[model samples]
Target: MEEADSCRRAALEAVADVEPPRLHEYLDSILDRASMVPAVLTLESAAAMRTEGRVLEDADEPHRDGESEPDRNRTQAVSSDRDPARITTHAAGVQLIYEGLRLTRSLAHDEPWTATDAEASDADLGILAADILVARGFYLLARTDAADKAVRTVQSFGRDQTRREDLESGAETSAGTAVGIDGGDPASTDANLERDVLELAVRTGAVAVGETPSPRLHAVVAEFAADVGTSFPPVADCLTDLHARARELSLEDSTTDRATSATDP
Candidate 1:
């Protein structure tokens, strides 16, 4: 939870330097209106699965035994507290804000809406906030220790969000899963979007931690995402399952384990 708050503050700090206070206020209102607590909790949990308390170095640079990355670039400490991966989770959450603004005609912060004449202007501002957040989210990812993987994960995020937001059921997801965004006729019960976001978090953090995830680890994260996306009972149990499976595979190299209990009862 502390980690979440830290990342939340980091997110605010991301846009705090805007020259115009109005734009900054819009950004602030977006986060201020959204209950980012759950999203932050999931992000911190996934980030915790990564290497902890270790300073990251450029993968391009070689290191001796037991040596951290070369300290030539002493710019910032990406420790768990300021994890960009976790912060990206919140950045991606701007979509939720956009959804609220468009669907509810207000930010839902209980702000005065008497100025119905200002609806278009407010919507424009909200859209701008969402757009800035998307760019910021991708920017944060591109700055990670694993730039390639981080960027790809965010790309997948875009595709997944587009697939879900298309309002058309049975859209073929990039992963080849035909998930129904709406409940009218869900071809696949797997359209749980929470799992997709969390899985991306796990994969991004895994790469950031100097590890290539195994298929079992992927399956574990996917299952947890599925459980949480579908509102399965005891979602925390899903997270526990992910932690145990990830820990088990952590002890083995990428080649040893490929099968998992995903299909098990």
Candidate 2:
């Protein structure tokens, strides 16, 4: 859980320096939901464990004699200071990206700006905060193997949002009344966001541990996401099960490869 806490702190620190006190406050408010278990971080941690054949709790082991402060606080490293492959860094990247998308979803669905001039300004700040959070996420991932996947995740979000917008417009234009965002199915859009981001988390985590996630691995991750469906602070037992399943799947793939190679000769 230290890794998850570190990820949450890193994400907040990433956006801490935004100008305008109100904007910083707004950003903090937006990230308030991060108090949950951080599903993306959990997935990434699980995948990393699967790839390394190690345990997540190992990070929590007591330090050896004379361990420096930096060693104790490595989990809290800033975006530029940490290794790109560190699971905490990668997890924070996906976390920021998801939070940004989540804020955007709220703006689109709630339309909070239409309330008044002050609310309009607040909405603008919210948009700015979302941009900052996503940019920070990309900054964290810019040098990692998962960079391309991270880019695609954001692109996918844009495409989904655009599709939802077009659908909303069609509904309003035809029905002569607001049919609600995505025809009163906001949960589906949010689920799509969570599913894609969680997949990215798994891929990035596996990459961090020096393995490219196979299709079978991706399939298992997808199944896990589908079964969980946007539940935050994922259950510990479920995460442990996912970790075991991923390792099993990886082992099966390795066995299949060995068998195929044996017959080829």
lDDT of 2 at 217: 70
Per-model TM-score versus the true fold: 0.53, 0.71
Candidate 1 Cα RMSD (Å): 8.9
Clashing pairs in 1: 195-225
Stretches of candidate 1 off by over 4 Å are 33-117, 145-193, 230-265
Candidate 1 versus the native: TM-score?
Answer: 0.53
Tens digits of per-residue lDDT for model 1 on 1-265? 3444555565676667754789888787765554443344335334544543345554345555665445433322434424465545443443332222222322332243445658757765765666676556555555555445434544554554455444344435434654434443322322433444455455455544444555766766665554444333332433455555566665553223223334445
Highest TM-score scorer: 2
RMSD of each: 8.9, 8.6
Error of 1 at 41 (Å): 7.0
